[model samples]
Target: MPHARTAPALSLPIQDARERLRVLIRDLAVVRGRVVLSSGAEADHYVDLRRITLHHEAAPLVGRVMLDLLQREGLVPGIEAVGGLTLGADPVATSILHASAADPALASLNAFVVRKANKAHGLQRRIEGPEVAGRRVVAVEDTSTTGGSVLTACEALSQAGADIAAVAVIVHRADASRAAVEAAGHRYLAAYDISELEI
Candidate 1:
């Protein structure tokens, strides 16, 4: 028989965890240089948050910080699941799921993945993991530029009968992204903005 895995202990206080995550993101994820963004726009720097989101140390911190953010913003109570479009949001959603396991109040929180397209075979499901029907969910992403990706996830979630509580991200790169999400009628929450990253 296989042994049951345990949730990792929440070691740092939320404030400490958030600060540590900020430093890690600043040091590891911010790439300073001319680059084209996913929206095909040119920028002087790029925030490739996957570097920290998928990191061993930083990933846990991400969970802690993000969970705290949701709690502080009062978005956690009825949020049954967290996720966004696949790829960028994959590790972020998983991190939140793992972190929630360490907290009694949030242990019921689940994670889901929004596939770019429905699986051709099997159940032909567009959203993977636990069922999200009729449950309130928060969409998560590592970074948002135009909010297109997260919005896409929200659309699929709505189609599947899930109520979108809000959209959250580790970094908010453009003000336009926030506007776009709000224009779509969902609250936008970001743990850090580019100014805080000092890039």
Candidate 2:
């Protein structure tokens, strides 16, 4: 009889995963030029986090780092699920759940996505995926400038009966985001802050 293959390790060293993400963000995501942000503010530098979060190699790294932040920090006890706003946050939420499959120590987390607006037809839902009602959820975003996007999702998820436990972002470009999220009563965490990306 053939021997069963062992499952690979689900979690990496938190610092190593964070370092990998830091390098990936600096190399592949930073774009130097004037660009309009999601908040409609013009900025000289734009960090295109999707470039990293959506990449084949970096996406997994992003998920690992973020899960480490949430799981290891004891920030949101009993967080049963994770989610974020559509488009920017889709990958982060998905990746973390995917990565969790390998780690027996972590609870399997469900992923939900909040739409920019409610769909006009079908279920006509503002939020999609597993029912988040009463679920402790950690919301993530790709890049946060003014915290508007995460706030939008949080409000919707909250209304849907989800306990918005905490918020995480792959790239935090300004203190405004941290302040805004914290003010809303959710501890804000980041894989890489703006100052860390200044290279």
Candidate 3:
């Protein structure tokens, strides 16, 4: 008779990711409130992703979370770079960059950013920092209500001949933004969504 095959032992309970995300949000104080989105419309809730992403403790956590997500999907494709829109994407991109620094497989991931508008002088480059042409990149942002900034950055990166692998957000507003990303055919990963983080 053939030997029976058994599944590998698990280390934790199900819904572990969701529960951890909720606790992190609550601990970081990501909350709901009236605010304007990148699309210039009033919103019932706002996720000040900086409240978490900028924290000394939160930064590493964000990195681990993103790395875990990619790992779970069995997607370990290396990124030639990581970046997004200027202000909102700053911290999240930095977190990815810092995390990559500690991992030998990801240490080559360069950091870059897109300007809201061209400088009109000097280099006049929309993309600043390491060259991104012909590279696979991961874009990150703080919050997305309409997904304008993320799209804009993607467009610029594409125009520069880049392959956008995925996008990561600190908090997903769970509105039209998700649809926008799906429409563009890129995987979207969020640390927390509005309903999940609401008080």
Candidate 1 structure quality by residue, lDDT tens digits, 1-199: 9755434327776777778789889999999899999899999889999999888788988888898899999987668999989999999999998888878866468999999999999999999999999998999999989999999999999999999999999998899999999999999999998889987
TM-score per prediction, in order, is: 0.94, 0.90, 0.79
lDDT of 1 at 60: 87
CA error at residue 177 for candidate 3, angstroms = 1.0
lDDT of each: 0.90, 0.83, 0.72
Backbone N/Cα/C clashes per model: 0, 0, 0
Which residue pairs in candidate 3 collide?
none
In model 1, what lDDT does residue 118 have? Answer: 95
| Candidates, ranked, lDDT | 1, 2, 3
Candidate 3 structure, TM-score to reference: 0.79
lDDT (10s digit) by residue, model 3, range 1-199:
9755422112223245346545656766554578776588986765666777776555566665665555565445566677899987877777766766766764445679899888899989989988888887878787788888898898888888888888777677766888898798887877666766655
Q: Give the winner by lDDT: 1 or 3.
A: 1
Candidate 2 lDDT tens digits, 76-177: 337888888899999999988887765676777888889999999999999999999988888889878889999999999989998887889887788988
Taking all chains together, the TM-score of candidate 2 against the true structure is: 0.90
